[model samples]
Target: MDNLTHGLLGLAIGALRRPDGQRAPAPGQGPRLDGPGLRWTSPTDRAVLFGCVLAAELPDLDGFLPAADPVLQALQTHRGLTHALVFAPVWALCATGIARLIYRRARSRPVFSYSLASVLFAHLLTDLWTGWGTRILLPISDQRYSLDWAAVIDPFFTLPLLAGALWALARKRSWRRSLLVGLTIAAAYMGFRVGSREILVRRVERAYPAATRVEVFPALLSALSWRYAAILPEGYSLGRVSIFGPVEPVRTQDLPAELPERAADNPTVAEALVWARVPHVSIQEREGGVLEVRVADLRYNMGGEPTLQFVVLVGPQGETLEARLERGGTIGEVYRRWKDDRRGALPAEGGAG
Candidate 1:
């Protein structure tokens, strides 16, 4: 999920229940809603809300932390230790403490800490829906887990969450009920998407009896549509699934499962095989008869230029040389440059010049 969605989810969680555990206001202490916007009924509500929102975004702090290299950053940085379930409570404690100092509200520290921890846990849960797996149980094990149920950015998911948060931000009397209903609706929608993906995967598996692996990825903005790939011994096939329309024919591309004997030892190839959910490998020749072995993760393609890529340079005699893992389009215009470089260097007759 995106940062804005996380913040709104935090807002909804914060408004789920007040610190006092009263769903309704006191007999004569009804909340005021006549102002420009809804105001927190008490200092404690404001503090907890703020703390939850802050804790929701704290896991992304690793993006700002300096890393020795991109490999380290990809494997052990953002969405690494910070997003782990083990770290959520500790972070919630720190965040709640800061909120206490800021609001100085009359609330039990333990209660506030628990509420904030729940909000942080929500962040981890949301990330698990996307293809970019989160290291939820990190330290215990470095494995990343994902359901591949929702796209990183899904308006269908975010809109309801935002609506609930906004309602809570505006009207105080029934705020708790509003957020609970919103959260339930969002969860249901996610479940629907998961079910849809499962159907598509089954269809693909049935169509390709020889498929060794099959994975469905979420579309950019639509829950009704999905893209999937099935890995076969000789190559792989790609297709799009529409929940509302007839199934389209699958597109097959032939790519050997085995790389050149020389590239078998390349570290870059090893890294990408482990990292990519749908790995597509190709061998190309560059200048000076250098063998450029490329592996791309099709999960992030989204029908556009490829993003995540691992490249290795092999000598003329098939000896492994230097290798690199690169990403395109992350920083804008850089992707275009990478694309243009590849096109311009293409050998007209046969192989590299």
Candidate 2:
């Protein structure tokens, strides 16, 4: 999920708790007027809200590392150890120390540390929804986990949380109530997305009964549309299904995705394979006997937009010469880039993969 959603959820968590470390009473249990509209103007409330903001955004600090290589940065730092479960408490303690320095009163308030820690956990929880995923088991395992239920930047997921957090901030008396409502709505929305995803998965399964595996991703900003891919013995089939539109097959190359033993050892290829769910690997011959190898995820390419791909230059005998990241953009732009990369390597010129 995006940082904005993380921040808003942190604020909601902070606002849901009263300054006295007690949560607002459930509906009908407290004074009817004291519901969400009750404003508690306590210094602790301010401190807690500030602390939440700091904690939620803290996990993203790893993204600031001065790593030069995008792949190295992605594999080593971004959503790496810092976003792991074991590191959340350490992060919380560091955040608490910083908060204590900024807000002297925070040193005496245990609730500040607790709230900050909770918000940090919230940050990790929310990241599960993104396709980029997070490495929660860091030192023990480098496995990345994702729900694939929502896009990293879905307004359907963010808007309710944002609105609720804003409402909590706007109506002092109703802060707690508004926060609860926001969290509830967000949770329910996710449940809906999950249910919808399951249905879509079933639909795809029915459509491609021979598929050995199927994966579905929520379309950008939409719960009604999805991108799905299925692995078949021959190759893979990918397509899009839209509740509002028609379900159709995705454009894909008929090439096999299996990596030849010789090319599998390249770290660049390995990392690209790890990152892509439904990958397509292809070979091209360029001028001067150079071989161009590409490994890309089909899901991102299905939309006809710019998508990440690993392009490697190799010798005729499969010795890797150079490898770098490239992207496929809209049809025209991708055509130009592909054309440029294959200059003087066409089949008429005796170039063969």
Highest TM-score among the candidates is held by which one?
A: 2
lDDT of 1 by residue, 240-308 (tens): 677775454344555535776666665545655666777667787789988887777767653323466
Model 2 pairs whose backbones collide:
36-174, 37-173, 37-174, 38-173, 39-173
lDDT of 2: 0.68
Please give the distance, in angstroms, between residue 192's alpha carbon in candidate 1 and its true position after superposition: 1.2
Candidate no. 1 TM-score: 0.78
RMSD of each: 5.9, 6.8
Candidate 1 Cα lDDT to native: 0.70
Cα miss at 149, model 1 (Å)? 0.6
- Best-matching candidate per lDDT: 1
The total number of steric clashes, by the backbone 3 Å criterion, in model 1 comes to 0
For candidate 2, write residues 1-353 as lDDT tens digits.
67898887777777666554245546554433355444344446566777777788888899888654565466556888889888887767665667667667554355456555655546887887677788888899988888787888888777888888778668757667888788888889888888888888888888888988888886655668788778787666666786555556654344344566556766656766787777777776689877677877666643422267777766656566776667555769766654542232221111112
